[model samples]
Target: MTEAKAHIVAAVAQLIDEHGPAAVTTRAVAQAAGVQAPTIYRLFGDKGGLLDAVAEHALATYVSGKTVAEEGDPMAALKAGWDTHIGFGLANAAVFGRLTDPARGADSPAAAAGLEVLRARVRRVAATGRLCVSERRAVELIHAAGTGAVLTLLAMAPENRDLGLADAMYDAVLQSIVTDAPVRTADGPVAAAVAFRTVVPDLPMLTDTERALMAEWLDRAAGA
Candidate 1:
């Protein structure tokens, strides 16, 4: 985006931080950004377009600053990503709400990026042979748990918020995803299916056609 566009988004985001989403009128944002209301329309097309731009800007900025411990354990990296996600939600409630809101979420580029990050982390875990569920299933479960935990926490007053809820949710998701090993172990039948499915294409004993068919069977068996 151009510097002018960035300035306008920044001004609107600041207003959201100061007075919540309801206060972000075009006139208010234009005044704060030192631009006229027509400029916002000319640049963003409409209020909804402007709000979408703001949500994209906020999510992209947050994701750009996040780093997981890639040199160490994948689980640890996943945990770091989880903590970062929760922190971003709490720090930017309006943006988080906009990203997760059913009306807008399907079209939100940031939400898709966030999910892609989660999928990458889950794939790392699956690579270690420690994932007890299909990578796709694990990603879904973790994403759902984290999003629900953040929204739940946001619903309460700051002083009244139960911080443990996030940890507990993480624990629950971890139990469902990981096996009982320091790093690599297949724990159950479903997990076996999930793990085997991940490498089915490379199974030397099976022909290409056989591998393809086996993958379909394992995917179903893995609940994916």
Candidate 2:
């Protein structure tokens, strides 16, 4: 990004943080960035484009601070990520609301990157043989739960919020997706299939097609 574009995006993001998404008019942003409103139009095309840039900026920062635990308990790492996600949403309500909008977020690379972070965490659990469903299913469950938790909490007055709601949602998701202990292939095909699915690409001497075929079969067996 050019220095001037960076300056404009930062200015608009501050406007969002200070006022609200509704306050992010071209006039306001232009005033904030000390440029003509047409400069914003020239640089960003329009308000949606400006907001998209801001979303990418915000999610990039948010995703960077996130760490999928490298050691110790993978579940613990996932829970930490959950907390971070909720905290950011509550703290950045205006921007979070905009980014969560289906129309805008559907095409967002940063939003997709955010999902990949969740997928990595799910993959870690699967690799540990603790996932009781397909990795795709586990990721979907956690993502839907997390998004619901944030939106539910945001809908309420902060003082009226159920402080335990987010934790309860996490527990519910865990119940559906995680096993208390690793399951052996003899005990169940689902968890074992999920576990092996993580390593199928690395399996020795397999052609790409072979790996793909195995993955398809495993995905079906795991009920994704």
Model 1 steric clash total: 0
Off by over 4 Å in 1: 67-70, 182-187, 199-214
> What lDDT does model 1 reach?
0.83
lDDT of 1 by residue, 39-141 (tens): 9999999998888899899998877776544567888899989988998899888878777888774876667777888887887777676787788889989
Q: Residue 10, candidate 1: how far off, in angstroms?
A: 1.3
What ranges in model 2 sit over 4 Å off? Answer: none
Candidate 2 residue lDDT tens string, 103-198: 764877777888999999999999988898999888888888888899999999989999599999999999989889998899978999999999
Cα lDDT over the full model 2:
0.87
TM-score of 2: 0.94
lDDT of 1 at 28: 91
Predicted structure with the largest lDDT when compared to the true one: 2
* lDDT of the candidates, in the order given: 0.83, 0.87
